[model samples]
Target: MMRSACALAACWWLPLSVPAAASPASAAEVLPPVIDVAGSIGIVTDYRFRGISLSDTHPSVQGSIVATHRSGAYAGISAYTLNGFGELGGSNLELDLYAGYRHNIGPVTVDAGLLYYAYPGSSGGSYEFIESYASLSARIGPATAKLSAAYSPPQDGLNGNGNLYLAGEVALPIRSTPATLRGRLGRSSGDTPLTPGGLYHEWLVGADYELGQVTLGAAITGTDIAAAEARAAGARPRDTRPTLSLTAALRF
Candidate 1:
């Protein structure tokens, strides 16, 4: 009786299989590989990097594209307009190339990557460097917390000096809403341009609201660099002053 029931079950499914096999389109259909590509373009009131305005306190345009593989490896490129700061060798364009891998272990996610900063068409000097970074993040209740570190080895572009940056971030999604609140505290040391006077702390508090394919954001960002230090370093007024920024971005 068990054998008879098994045969009947196979027979009952035969008609469904026959229709799919008989259709030429279904028989010859091919599925694409599982790579995902995503990108975003945006405009910000100021191009802030580590709490310093790279765009000289002016509006800047930026965009990025990334492609990810099924095995957790990804590569991306980002480009933005800058204000031709002296430290950047008066370069107006900044391009970043990066690649990384990310994977989840238990409830925590780990990400590690290498990034290259390139300044094309600079009139004064070479302003390019590379850095390696790693981060670990986990979700707690309604928020996600992350800790990250980035280190650049001694290189010619950095005047034979290097830099280190460590930061912690938290992002919380407002319940039943499309808004998310985010904050970060970071410390920079070594011999980076932004921290010319030893090490300084930077902080940011922001919120993002998603509207279909667009996201709107507002944030207050500042640094602990003193006015005298900023003046000696040739930093602009927006560098150490607490400033507000508004941004709009579209993702595809």
Candidate 2:
């Protein structure tokens, strides 16, 4: 589960607007709750999660839709193409369901969530799992800093008592420009649904250009997974190496 969450962690840093779902109140009254609905569709040179290719180094189509409440609660679903490398019991698609809450306190934001990963038509393999996570974020000068931790309890497809992951990210917006620079670092401990071994690290550096409701992005992502580990896990070692990616997405 932690592995699944780490794979989609890139979505965490987006600065989404929170509009009021209810009417405004007088100065002496409390603000009413609000609701927001957002969705996006995109194509990527490769579907990389935690710096490993889930699309067999091939391009993939991805999309997500989320509904949020002004009170800081949200639920959403995401789906993406999967390749042989994803090892989803022969399934060619991956769907994720998630629910979470986020709250702002002063200049800092705190969040927690649960995610369920599903691979339909999979059999005789560890394919479905769940994870829980918590995170904190704050603006630091021109950059936003975030730290998160996620855990998965012992379940099918995982070894031992599951996995733990810690990650941090920094996002910087270029002054007067539509581009934002981002960097991520993460560490994984315990057995992952994909990798049944020791600890590993993942890293990514990227930039995104926003054009109205569309975004263009590219990144260099890599992981310190060894050949032996990949072999034991039935994964490709090359998939863990630094890879270049270009992506375009439309938001609605």
Candidate 3:
């Protein structure tokens, strides 16, 4: 759990893999894609990635543009404004370019991909890295569950050390309503300049409601990262504090 990587893992980009429905806001709905080119924009009270706050407890805007093939191949870019972690030594935004393939194996949906985290306008520092990940997901009764793993090899962003993350999530829909309840658990371990030798455990529980093309969300997220370690790594205590966030998003 390097300092830099810790924030990045605050939440898995695909927390509960359910095709077009597996997004952070609709974790329980397993709706397959109905459109080829999808675009979305949203705002979050605090942008926390695997349980760490990346927005310094402030709100942030985020959006993504993705194109998916009927064969399950897709590519996209996602970005958000940032205020902490000295991204690029004080750069205030984070962008990700990613591509991947998804396939159904009987009752299970499998996804594999690569993602590159990029910071613009930061020079003379290690500010970018690539991660590879895969996930397995399936529908179980009235809910869906996912298991995922991500790895980043020794790279400049990681200061020549590797990082690993394992995560799981489950989402259940409310009866006869466009609402969902979701929960997540994850563990991260690694060696890097940010955290030296670090290990962390994190969890989240949340719910979301859909209204036409708009979605509303709220979550309570926390992590078991030691205060001593966080301070030693130059991270704020709020990163490990239980946080409540409200969100709204528009999809098209």
Candidate 4:
């Protein structure tokens, strides 16, 4: 499962006071730009990854820190608490390291990144894996739409199998209000421990209200996996059931 975190982009401009006789080159010899650092912490009613619950339908705490450069390169680390099910070898923590670059071409914004998932203090075997993702997004009227794909190459952690996830999302901001409506539809295919059924569809409809640096969100999320399929996958009954989740997050 991935922890969704928002980072505040920042840019700094310093005014350099020069003498009247100073040349233009002397004014340009100021300090180099600094990297922007942003952080966030939040709590969720349930820790969901893709369509499955990693926290066994329980609440989870998550946090993240990201550093961004002016050149559109960014790196971040995030962690969340989970139940540490069989797939995780009883490890209760999920940590992710990711880096990517974002660029704008005409009216479209492109983002590509690599993410590494690590389960610390896990036993039995390694539960680490890597995935690469790319996305293109554009603004349409008051709504923003994006299409993304994530792929994991065949590796030992996945038992020599690979996985692919494709998704589309749309977010609309209410005019003259602090609320935003969001929706997503996703499909997961291929072999992976997360989806024992080999394929499944997940969907989410959510809304978020901003209150300064704090934001409150509520969502209804569910997957198409049947009860039997979920059980057979070592997942709890609630994993496949339509559920409501509440979150309170603070960004800085």
All candidates: TM-score: 0.83, 0.82, 0.81, 0.84
Question: Best by lDDT, which number?
Answer: 4
Model 3 poorest ten-residue lDDT run: 4-13
Better of 1 and 4 by lDDT: 4
- State the TM-score for model 2: 0.82
Predicted structure 1: clash tally: 0
Error of 1 at 16 (Å): 22
lDDT of 1 by residue, 1-252 (tens): 000000000000011233444566664344323466667777788777777777778887877777777667878888888774654454577888888888789999888888888877665665677888888989999899999988888886666878888999999999999999999998888765546476878888988888887778888888888878777766654344444434443333
Per-residue alpha-carbon lDDT of model 3 for 1-252, expressed as tens digits?
233322111111232246663566574355444336666777787777767777777787887777776667777888888775554564577888888888889999888888888878866787688988899989999999999998888998887887788999999999999999989998877875434227788888888888877778878887887777766766543343444434443344
Of the candidates numbered 1 and 2, which has the greater lDDT value?
2
Model 4 superposed RMSD (Cα) = 4.3
lDDT for 235 (candidate 2): 56
Instruction: State candidate 3's TM-score.
Output: 0.81
Q: Which is the leading candidate under TM-score?
A: 4
How does each model score on lDDT? 0.70, 0.72, 0.71, 0.73
Where does candidate 2 have its weakest 10-residue lDDT segment? Answer: 6-15
Model 3: which residue pairs collide? 9-50, 10-49, 10-50, 10-51, 11-49, 11-50
What is the full ranking by TM-score, best candidate first? 4, 1, 2, 3
Off by over 4 Å in 3: 1-35, 85-91, 193-197, 237-252
